[model samples]
Target: MTQRTDVVVIGGGQAGLAAGYHLRRLGIEHVILDAQTAPGGAWQHTWDSLHLFSPAQYSSLPGRLMPAQPGQTHPDARHVVEYLAEYEKRYELPVQRGVWVDAVHRDGTCLRVASDSGEWQARAVIGATGTWTRPFIPAVPGRREFSGRQLHTVQYKSPAEFAGLRVIVVGGGNSGAQIAADLASVAELTWVTRRPPRYLADDIDGRALFDAATARRQALDAGHGDTGGVASLGDIVAVPPVRSARDAGLLPAKPMFTRLTSTAVEWADGTLAEADAVVWCTGFRPALAHFASLRLRGTRGHIATVGTRTVDDPRIHLLGYGDWTGPASATLIGVGRPARDAAREIASLLSG
Candidate 1:
């Protein structure tokens, strides 16, 4: 028998769950397919110490608030996962987890989505799989020759794992800074950036400016043309200079790494930096390869879309994609408005 629905939601994370919630509210028939055994997607596997920079209010979804007191920091990955599990049970959201979708294809006017269990046909599909699906590591010369272990920030869990190891963190983004700062006391840490960082002060208060900026970044990634303009990597905010760590000599400024072979890092000025380990805070890419039919490509093979619409196939939607506007797109606080907006768009298409 061919199972049919008005829409098929891929990924049971924040975006997909929100989309399912709205669809149910509108009385639209849909089924959520998640690869993981539970909700919360990548959060289920994130680092143990990871916490959101945004406070509670900004982290809330459209219909409910994340449990927290005023002025408290955003929940950590474990809390987030538990919260999503609660959200699912609270609303009785119909999400079928532990079933990985193998492929999705357009079948006539409907979409044919396949999972390990079976296939589903729907009038529309929502790609709520977040941007963290693929970690973006740049190709530096000699990377293959380096004998040390190299890992992306996504694979990183705790600094304790690297205690007493000489580590070089590449990229000056918040991830790099946080990782460097966290490991400074436990390990030999060297922070390397290609250029000076554009740092922003941490917002202790959950104000509109902070929340709105996050929402805007999410919108940009969702294919919504709502941002002002683009700027260089240096324009993205970084952590304030770690004067204390610096003064303690725990955080040393290392030269920009120009090449990475199998065993060593060649600095821009021709010095060799040895490392027992390397954490590439390079960034992430979209998880759109599964939708090869979309034919959307940009510089470096990036997808070109604003909020939900893939630039090539407006009929298709992308959720939780990052850098749609700039660096802010990847944050949880920023993804809410876009998720809601994309939900509305998805709803409209399904109804039509």
Candidate 2:
């Protein structure tokens, strides 16, 4: 038997929870289907050393603020997981754990969400499955011949295992920097980037970046020219650990290499450097494979979205994919506004 609902939120992560919050506020019937056996979403899969770039105050969902721990400046992955678990419990959100959504397609006036557990016929669907599962590693020449340990950031756990070895950390993003910093204490680390790493001012954190992005978005929406001085979240925030690493002269990065040798990496200048391992922190792609059957993907394999609603399928909405779906929707605080807007839209559509 197919269960029917007003909405079906895929992936019970931060974005999904936020969407559920708004849907509940509007008295809308909805169910969240989570692939994980428990709560926490991607936070449960993060590296042991990972910590939020923002403080607890700035890293919160729509209704409740993440609780702050005394003397703890930033929340760690475990802390975030605990908070997410508690948030779901507090709201009494209807979440079906371990229900993996396989595909979603239009079924007459409703959408059919097929999952391992069951199927849901919903008036609207929200895809909040964020990018953690789809880690992106750029192809490099001779990569297949490399004998040394090669892993993406998704598989990284602790630096302790890499002790006394030569490690190469690839990519210039915050993950690359943070992982490289973590490895420096136990290993000889080399940071590689396609371009020079951009570091934001030490005083700036995720809060400031979010505010700046919000202001920039508001200005553009109001028909004003881009007030381009605001810094983006892409620029690394000098968090305490990262700051310490920088002060200790361990945060320097080298230009990207041309190819990978069996036991070493060759630079653009044909210089070879041997390494025991290569950690690729190359970021992620949206986990939208479940929607592939819908054939709604536009340029760059991204679903065309105007505000959270899919341009190709008005009944489907995307949340927390990134800026392409909505401004800063990938972050904790950023997902709320879009979720709210999407829920309101869904409610309006269903009511009509």
Candidate 3:
């Protein structure tokens, strides 16, 4: 028997939860299908030392604020996991755990969401599956011949694993900087980036970045050009640990190497740096493989979205995939507004 629902949210992460919150407020019936057995979404998969670049007050969902811990400025991965679990319980959101969605296709006027557990025929489908699973590693020449350990940011757990060894951290983003800082304390670390790393002012944090992004988005929406230069949330924020690393003169980043040798990396200038492990913090791509059958994906593998709704399919909305869906929508605080609007749109569609 095919289960029927007014809406089927294809992820129980922050975005999905936010959508559910708004849907419930509007008296709409929906179910959130989560692939994970537990709560926390992608945060559960992050490294132990990972902390939010924003403080607790700035990193919250709609209708409820995340409680700030005493003496803790930024929330860690475990704290986020706990908060997400509590948030789900507080709202009594209808989330089905361990239900991995395989594909979503059009069935008559409704959307058919096929999963490992069962199929759901929903009037609308929200793709809130974030980019944790699709880690991106740039191809480098002679990468296959590298004899040392190679791991992406998704697989990184602790710097203790690379302690006392020569490690090379790749990418110029926040993850690369943070991981490089963490490993610098106990390991011989080399930071590599395609271009020079950009660091925001010491006083700046994730909250400022979010505010800047919001302003830029609002300006663009109002038919005005963004004339100011604002640092994105992806830029390094110089958190306490990062600052400490910088003060110690250990945060120097080198240009990307040309190729990988068995136990060394060859630079553009033909300099060889021996390394025991290489950590690629190159970031992630949207996890939209389940929607491949819909044939809505563009050349970049991302569906064309017009403010969260698919350009081709109005009933299909994407959340938390990044700026294309909505500005800063990938963050906790950013997902709320878009989710609210998406829920309202879905409600109107169902009613009509």
Residue-level lDDT of model 3, residues 48-76, one tens digit each, is: 88888889999999988999866789989
Tens-place lDDT digits, model 2, residues 180-232: 88998899899998888887888887777767777777888889988553444
Q: Higher-TM-score candidate among 1 and 2?
A: 2
Whole-model Cα lDDT per candidate?
A: 0.70, 0.89, 0.90
- From the highest lDDT down, the ranking of the candidates is 3, 2, 1
Q: Please, what is the TM-score per model?
A: 0.85, 0.97, 0.97
Which pairs clash (backbone N, Cα, C closer than 3 Å) in model 3?
none
Enumerate clash totals for all models, in the order shown: 23, 0, 0
Question: Candidate 2, TM-score vs. the true structure?
Answer: 0.97
RMSD of every prediction? 3.9, 1.4, 1.4
lDDT of 3 at 127: 95
Residue lDDT tens for model 1, 1-352? 6799888888888877877777777787888888888677788877666666556666766577788744444556777787788888787888998877777787888888877889899887878777676899887877777899999989999988899998899877667766777788888777887776544444332244444555556676688977543232233332233434544766555668788756667876778767899999888776666576645667678777755676665556777665462233345554565666666777777667
Clashes (candidate 2) = 0
Assess candidate 1 and give its TM-score to the true structure: 0.85
Scanning candidate 1 in windows of ten residues, the lowest lDDT window is: 232-241
Weakest ten-residue segment in model 2 by summed lDDT: 227-236
